[model samples]
Target: MGRALAGAVVAAAVAVATLTGCSLRIEEASCGGGEYPVLAVNSGGGDCVPDGEEPAQGWARYPEGKVPEKVGDEWDIYWSTHTLDENGEIIELPEGG
Candidate 1:
């Protein structure tokens, strides 16, 4: 009886671990249908705009080489403290950035 109980407990533990592991997919942040994301040029702000619409005033498309594909991704992190000047040059943000 003791051996059987211990075997059952081990099986249950394995089942629990398998179930949890199967559900551990990392979901990516997304912009839902018909919209795309853009970042504010000189600030830590962003938005999702419709596919046919342009970024609003004070905001701009991320530069070709540095566009972020996911929230908190490498490019996204870099953009938080950097921006493009009017001439399209990359510049470090001011203090308190």
Candidate 2:
């Protein structure tokens, strides 16, 4: 009886861990109003760099909220920005082209 109870407890623990253990990985985290869980800042809304006509050329923060220039080799950022602007235009950077 004790063995059966122990097995059941272990099974329950494993199930809980599987359901809540950082499984939902973000692909592109952006800073927007409609975004659900943005892990980084949105670089398109603010003032872009000089001589930059496109937002894609601007620098965006990583998923961990670190600037692209500040992040190190060990840092890995994942995010997916699918939202659009007021004109209903999907703003995508030039990279990944």
Candidate 3:
């Protein structure tokens, strides 16, 4: 019974971690013309920033459509609305911000 309880606790911890694992850290960003305008940023343990300024860092690239949008002038990334800032660093919003 003790072993089973421990296992359940561990499983719960894993589940919680997985639920909050996805995180987006926008270091630099910009939007413009093109079929798939790129938003330079470091996301999901990868660097998607444009320019060869820092190749040593692994940046991931995402289409403009996939990028999140900001809520008004605030730095909140509204994933639900599918809107995000086109330039500058990204800011994280609270649970309901």
Name the lDDT of candidate 3.
0.39
Candidate 3 lDDT for residue 33: 24
For candidate 2, which ten residues in a row score worst on lDDT? Answer: 69-78
Local distance difference test, per candidate? 0.77, 0.37, 0.39
Poorly placed runs, candidate 3 (over 4 Å): 22-97
Instruction: Give TM-scores for every candidate, taking all chains together and pairing residue i with residue i.
Output: 0.64, 0.23, 0.23
> Per-residue lDDT of 32-69 in model 3, one digit per residue for the tens?
22222233233322222335444332333343344433
**Which of the predicted structures, 1 or 3, would earn the higher TM-score when compared with the native?**
1
| Total clashes in model 3, counting residue pairs 3 or more apart in sequence or in different chains | 11
- Model 1 ranges off by over 4 Å: 1-25
**Candidate 1 C-alpha error for residue 31, in Å:** 2.6
- Model 1, range 1-96, lDDT digits (tens) per residue? 999999999888878879888543464664677877777676666778889999888877778877777777898788888887666678898877
| Clashing residue pairs in candidate 2 (N, C-alpha, C atoms within 3 angstroms) | 27-78, 27-79, 27-80, 28-79, 28-80
